[model samples]
Target chain A: MTMTNDAQAVLPPVPGLEDDDPPQLTPAQKKRATSRHLAFQGGTAGKLLGYFGMLAAVLLFFVPLYFIVVTSLKTHGDIYSNPISWLPNPFAPENYSYVINEVRFDKYLRNSVIITGILTVVEVSLGVMTAYGLSFLRFPGRNLLFLLVIASLMVPNQITVISNYALVASWGWRNTFQGIIVPLAAVAFGTFLMRNHFLSLPKEIMEAAELDGTGFFRTLFRVVLPMSWPTLVAFTLITVVNEWNQYLWPFLMSDTDAVAPLPIGLTQLQDNEGLTNWGPVMAGTVLTTVPMLIVFLILQKQMIKGLTAGAVKG
Target chain B: MATVEYQQASRIYDPSRPPAVNRVSLTVADGEFLVLVGPSGSGKSTAMRMLAGLEPIDEGTVLIDDVDVSELRARDRDVAMVFQSYALYPNMTARQNMAFALQNAKMPKAEITQQVERAAAMLELEVLLDKKPSQMSGGQRQRVAMGRSIVRNPKVFCMDEPLSNLDAKLRVSTRAQIGSLQRELGVTTVYVTHDQTEAMTMGDRVAVLREGVLQQVDEPTHLYEHPGNTFVAGFIGSPAMTLIDGATVSSDGRALLGPDHGLDMDLPREYAEKTPGQVIVGVRPENWEIVGHGAAPEDGGASMPLTVRLVEKLGGEAFLHCRAQETEGMTASVRGSQLVLRLDHGFKGIEPDTTIHVRPKPRTSVFFHPENEINLEYL
Candidate 1:
């Protein structure tokens, strides 16, 4: 009886406060107001301090990018100069053109585009379906299978290199797109991400569809798939970035210049010229990350939502 | 619309454990509105899900229009359901959500459009058809759910506490809307809710379930006036009916009158015959006519002594909480009217320890067998 009374006592005060005369802000609210005032007020010095802090953080990130851009713009003589100035004077457009027209940079760019594009498409589509199959569909050993896939998360790419090479040699798929592209497909992280994404959807939604006479695949396709776009886009961006800058896997798989992507091509140039063709090397690096940055800006909304959805569940 | 008959339909989740819904046999006539009412984990949801083909039936047959639906897949079964959560497709617009079934069936684009428009108009969602589920309010999303089901025009409409998610005021109005809409469509509908008010007001017949068993199924008035057991007796009414343990005072296969028992009445032979050991008496609040002070015991309208423990004065009628000295543990609700004798006013005037005496409404009084807990209604 006292338990009920205590529960009742906890509830009635809320109603009492609601029904009370216009509330005067208490000391707690005053403290909150004072803290907010300190952050916002204290005149010009506070505003300047806030701006300075932001500027310092921005400079910390921007310095490396500035160094890369300046190195790309300088000539070989300018790069080897005793003192490195913050700015590059007498900038040369020849470095960009030389990397573009003379160094077979176009082939590397084209190869990178094809490999990344094909690999991303494979990874996202297959990952989503695999996730859907494992998450939504019920089969035998589903828990064990998911655990196995999660187990794969801990296995580094190095562990698979020898076994994958043996398989590639047996298939005679070396220097082939299949060898390069297929190995990167069915990534475990993508599968796990989409599975977790599907898991986060309200179970009531599935029950509702079931009661509405929707089939298992229908529910997955109509309800589950449509809501999974944010995850798909995030997975796509991640795979693109991974496949875009790939060096070791591509280098091991493809031997000829025909299939060598930008990373390998730039490494080859570094080996050949050593310190002389630093201009074109820096230029290629700049070119590599520019498209990634551009793509990120376009789909940043979906990426952020997908990333945060796992943490903030329904 | 169709009649649904569940013949020994039992939903046993774990074979070792008891069924969630055990051996439920009931028939819902075509176009009859039936509401299944029970608390959480009472298997009302399990029963609705069984009817919806969301839960598998373990032991019996569910017949829709005399065709067994136990083997049928949910899509082929064609039973539309509106969920409590309103499970609208979050990504699609309201129109698309409503038209999803038709699209899945490979209907023509024009036909799908026409059906979507019709459903949107019927559900009053024409203005909001372009909005996604996230953009719509609770009520609008509920209407969209209704639209999705209405487009299918299934044989029966099963709703699992559809209005439980709405605000109080919206729940009241939506309850009326759903009731009228169910009648208008003339579909055999099975609605589930824990609220007796909803069960009483919206259902043509209300079925009360408890803990995986069907307690009673009857018309609202009949169920209210007559319950099958003590469970139904207490669960059906508000300000729950209080029971005086028959073991405490009953004697010689008969109910003993308290010292202030004004209305001297004998128990009917059925209760006295079966329940000599212990009997549970059931009475609603409105049954009692509050007696005035110093009322004679043997008068035509027999009166018992009572202390007005608490008074709640409503505009037309009021509730008087009276306590009997014989059983200090119990409280009785007496009607508030102009009594022959006046009572004290003001909250400060009433004493917490004061007593009251009142007679039960013997004509409407019911006695239940304490062993089986079955109410023995006098013929």
Candidate 2:
């Protein structure tokens, strides 16, 4: 029989700190005191430094935007004479009117809105459906299908542009809205994001739905979709912005102003009397940036939520 | 209401390993509540899931009202389940959750609302009908889950450890509520739980399983008094029965006391004849009494020397946890030396580390075959 020494079995105190009386301050108290001291003595200086750093960063981002606004308002004479100046010597609202009147701004704006709207709807709805199927359903070759989808993410759009152009030309979809939207409607990132969100949904709730006699599509629409609005809204915002700012496909595919969006339309403002006119181009650019900026301001909350959906539970 | 039957249903998850649920046959009469009770991985839950058509039956058929439903999907089988998580839809109010099945079946909107309201009233959940699951308490969510099932009015209600998530006091009250509710609804419910107390208190009949195999199926009282084997004998009762082996039969068909030869008791003729070599003796804690410290053993009752280990005194009764020391010629047949005796609450003053002599009440001890551990009554 082996008997262990009971006294020895008791855990020993930390090295060199063994004593009957404990430390005066508990660890939490010590932490509070140390933080307080740091806040009073060092934190003020560090906080000031941080504020200045943030100011610098904010200025770095906004200064270019301010320059664009000022340049857009300046006349061509003022732009050529003093390019770096902040103020538009003669605040000309005419540059905007000129870009609007001379170029098909209304047509291009309408095209951009239609393309972006339809693309966002198709992409998000298709993404959610694909994600639900990928995450919830158990079908043969599911892993292989998901692997193929993920593999597609690694293939750059440029490599497929020629083949896609050939296919579209053969389908006679050139210069059509379908040509612009359909080629890039189902994005891999959207699927990946939505799949992760759907996967994180509690499995019990889904099983409960199944036993409740709800069909798969009904469960997805009624149960899964309603709970995932933040992620979906965020994804919608991202897709809207991406499709709104699309340049290469629209530029190459559209043979006329009918299908071209603002990004392609902006090029028309570049030439004026055989010289590149900075004023109208800057004007068109500023107008294009304003819509997205407002969209971002309104939907930043959902965008952040969607981007971080599975990283933390709501 | 309809009768449910599992005709040798089995679920084999993998070909190389043993089946998760071996061919298990059982039946529940119309409106009867049968409990599948066992420890985890014992296939009790699997049996319930197989009945619900959640787990596919690889072998044999499950019949609902004598119609084979082994090939039917969960929804097509028309059975409702209450999950242990109380899986109420987080986004929906309790009323909507209850009405979901009807809504999906394309029932009229007015009828759906009326049915939901009736189920809500029956569960006393009318006040909580507007609240989502996240806003409700655990007991309220459990009631909502039950309401969801009850609204369906299906042939069978499958409950898988639905009360396990509740607090102890709430579990007790809700257990009573569910038992009475099942009786009132008169729906055939197959309840699965690992709690023997729940199995005993709630079910019309309890079926015990071990290692994916059915062990015994009987009324709770019958199961308690006449367990078919050692597993049930030890598993059924709280403070489990203390089983001792190495007891042999004497020439007169009486059991000879351990090695000390201080005790002799007559074995039941059936036990003596079936167990000729070595026999296991089982004594439940309550069947044991501690006579006065030096009281003489009488009337052929068997006594053993016990060293008191611990005492748990509940106001009305005391459980004396003790260890019995093997005497000369007694081989170690029991896995551990620990034993327990029940004493009246007023009988105080049992101290630790003190030796005392205890005897099993006459005719209360049982015998089992040493090899298979089956009760001698069956052997």
- Candidate that would win on DockQ: 1
Model 2: C-alpha RMSD to truth?
Answer: 6.5
The DockQ value obtained for model 2 is: 0.31
lDDT score for residue B148 of model 2: 96
Q: Where does candidate 2 stray beyond 4 Å?
A: A1-60, A75-90, A136-138, A170-172, A271-276, A297-314, B257-260, B264-266, B292-302
Each prediction's whole-model lDDT (CA): 0.77, 0.84
Put down candidate 1 lDDT per residue, A162-203, tens digits, no spaces.
898888878988888888888778678998999998998888
Q: Please, what are the lDDT tens digits per residue for candidate 2 over residues B1-379?
A: 9999988889999989988899899989999999999989999988888888778999999999999999988889899999998867766788888999999999999999999988888899999999877778889989999999999999999999999998999999999999999999999999999999999999999999998889999999988888899899988988888888777776557665554465554467666777765678888889876754544445444467777889887767778888876666555355466887787653466678877777677788877788899988876
Predicted structure 1: lDDT: 0.77
What DockQ does each candidate score versus the true complex, computed on alpha carbons? Answer: 0.31, 0.31
Q: Ten residues in a row with the worst lDDT in model 2 chain B?
A: B292-301
iRMS for model 2?
8.1
